[model samples]
Target: MLDHDTAPTGDKTIETAEDLSSIAFGFMASKALFAGLHVDLFSALADGPKTAEDLAKAIGVPLNRIVMLTTALASVGLLTIGDDKKIENSPAAQNFLSKQSKYDFGDYLRYQIDQQMYPFLLQLNAVMKDDLSEDAIASYKHWMTDEEQASVYSESQHAGSLGPGRTLARKVDLAKATSLLDVGGGTGAMTISLCKEYPELHATIIDFPNVAEIGWRFISEAGLVDRVRYIPGNAVEVQWPGNQDAILMSYLMSGVPGDDVEGLLRKAYEALAPGGRLMVHDFMVEEDRRGPALAALWQLQHMAFTPEARSLSVGWLTEAGRKIGFAIDDVDALIPAMTKLVVFSKPA
Candidate 1:
């Protein structure tokens, strides 16, 4: 027992266990939201408040399940129980969770939670025991081999990337660059955003054939078909186009085998014109690899598929680029605390 008023501060100070508990039980909150989104519960609440019975009828779930779900959602701040005893979408849910909302991310969450990550995470123990061999689980490439799965994977990634894509567009200056090489650019989300920002720019996206088909559709829908083109191939082995003034590799590095990341950077270096800029944006851990909680978790998620998957560090990238003759230009968070953009320029 210690007196708080006279307790010695420093590292010896006792902290509440709530932080640990919160982390331990995080999946509950996640699954609650997943369940709500799964049946379009938020969409049903978009019009107005409804009794749990009404929600059950709307989504075809049991009344008692709806009652429990709405309660859990309210606990998670995604829903609210009004004095009238009706359940309603919280402002956050109405704006971003509802399927009718323009910023709806339900599909993204569905694809990530229901289709991909949730299943992968359940095998964490086995993955940790092995070296994350291919036998443990299917790699991203394996999943993408199926056309429908590729489309779903691409669209989900597009939804999540669009916001950060806009953020990156605002942060980087591309006014002078006329052409860009979007390596492993799925669905052309970033390229579409950037090209929209700079009307004079043109971009070529390189991805697997299935993914490129989906990307072409997205670019066409953006009315950027003429400015953005797709080239189908594995970026790691394909010959890069050398005429580009800028190259972007967003959310790509961590998926590359750890030993090959440098080789990939070297390829990007060789493909750039004099003074061309190269931007690598992905989830990166701290130099000491202690924690950026989500990024560390994501790195583990990557490990469940790829044997060599590991999060890159900003410090490592900066020094690696320097050795490859790329002058470091900027390193900034694109989606603060989750993803970072490391920019390097090839000297003339």
Candidate 2:
């Protein structure tokens, strides 16, 4: 046992008991955020700073209760309290959490985490032990069967995906590709982004019927109706449109069952014209898979629901693409450290 002063210099061990305590109590902060989103606390503070009592009134909560929540939020840096005792949204909270903001993703967080993931994770231990109930382990396929649940998921995912879609547009050069196939393209978020980025580009999005309904609304709202089309079917079972210049499968690889991944890639290969590009973007870890904690955790989250889902890594994708007779063009991070985009091309 080494004292704090004599701990190994290069090691990243806990410096103090408080550090370990912070890790143990990490869920408290997450719960605080969930509660804040639940009561529309960030949105309430969006207009301006307000007294604790005024905030309670704004959100229709009791004064003391609002104060306790606000204090916790402020402590977690999601909100701030001035010397005058007025609370306001922090910069991040104002921009992303507030409903009025253009970049708002509060609903995404609310639905994805508070409503779905949090409850799903409660059975994680059982899931790992293969002891979870069959009915309770609702995979993405089962979830999509429920119209209401599918609508909720598609709506929230559309909102969350738009920013990342825009990011993808910036990172990849698709200017010359006149036609695109967006496989499993939920709500047309990525298609809309690509269409908006390239005026000459036309895209066909393939997804479930319920998801296509939502996708049409988004595509119409984006004013790309003429340039984009939605094909409603199971991406795996449906006959895909062929001879495409580019194919993008964002978030598709990790969402599907492990057994289906290779088939999808084969389909993409067969669907594309010779020399066509296939962009595979999803939560992918490093080859060694030692870190990039968020990416690994997301893969685990998928496993909790989809027992057959596999952890994807750049190494695996590259090798798989090579085996499919694709020439690797690029492999890079799409969503910073959380996701990767690998571009492969069929020989002309």
Candidate 3:
């Protein structure tokens, strides 16, 4: 009975049942996409269109089931039906989902979401209730203790980071920076990007030993062995090398225990020379703590592993940095709406 003037402000109303249904049924769509990636469906269709029967044979599914699978994918716009009624990948699927494409991120999606985050997300209710057992909580450090698990996680993370690293490199100006420190730098993605941009830059990455091993492979492949090196230790516990021109901490803040946040900031502060820039790129909730759904969900995901993980806000981080003698330089988006890069500079 409420008209526009009588409606509650800032309250969402269900205009149609479809909106609620879409939200409820969202998981099925995600699972369908994951199922497609599992069988390398996009890669099979990379060359051209194929008959459903051919896809069945290629993906080892029967014709009936293959049709159903393709139907699900097509409904989600990841696949399409041709004029000839053959199945094919859509433009987006062909570009980033196909294995033949250099921009392929299928493995990162499969490994991180399907294998890791999906499992943790199931425990979100338990996390919210604060009833998760100590044994049940598996932090990143615990996973790093197992070599195979660490390698699998780090490899996919490295793949995921490369594009963002390139994006960050484009966004931030590091033309004058020579010595750079990348704290908790997974596989040296940020370092590689920065070094590639500034040829005169030499960088050091600090991360877990297992992660450092994987990082070396990536650095070596990039052919920057001479300019980049890894200092293998926990970034919070290690003796960080000093007098850096810039320090980049991408995706580190939200992953650490709540108590360590300020200490880590202080460490970065002390480690930098006067006028050095410290860049923090992570998922930060809005100052009002309202829902920017993806960033909030990512912060919740961190709690699945690190139970003591704290949600960050730009206001809080800026205030914290100011308390440590850092002046705010800039705040900008790193991953569109999901992540932000906050730059702070130590006064000369």
lDDT of each: 0.84, 0.86, 0.87
Tens digits of per-residue lDDT, candidate 2, 128-217, equal 788878677546767787788788889988889999899989978988899999999989888889889999999999999988987799
Residue pairs with colliding backbones in model 3 are none
Models sorted by lDDT, best on top: 3, 2, 1
Candidate 1 has its poorest 10 consecutive residues by lDDT at: 1-10
TM-score of each: 0.91, 0.92, 0.92
**lDDT digits (tens) for residues 66-124 of candidate 1:** 99989998997999999999999999899878989988888889886568778878677
Clashes of 1: 0
Model 3, 1-348: lDDT tens digits are 111121122246568889999988998998889989988999999999999988889879889878988999999899999888799999999988899998888888888788888888877788778887666755777767778877878888887888889988997888988999999998998899899999999999999999999889999999999999999988889999999999999999898898999998999999999989999999977765664567888999999888888998777998999999999988877786678888999999
* Deviation in Å, model 2, residue 333 alpha carbon: 1.6
Give the runs in model 3 whose Cα sits over 4 Å from its true position. Answer: 1-17
What are the clashing pairs of model 2?
A: none
Ten contiguous residues minimizing lDDT sum, candidate 2: 1-10
Task: State which candidate, 1 or 2, has the greater lDDT.
Answer: 2
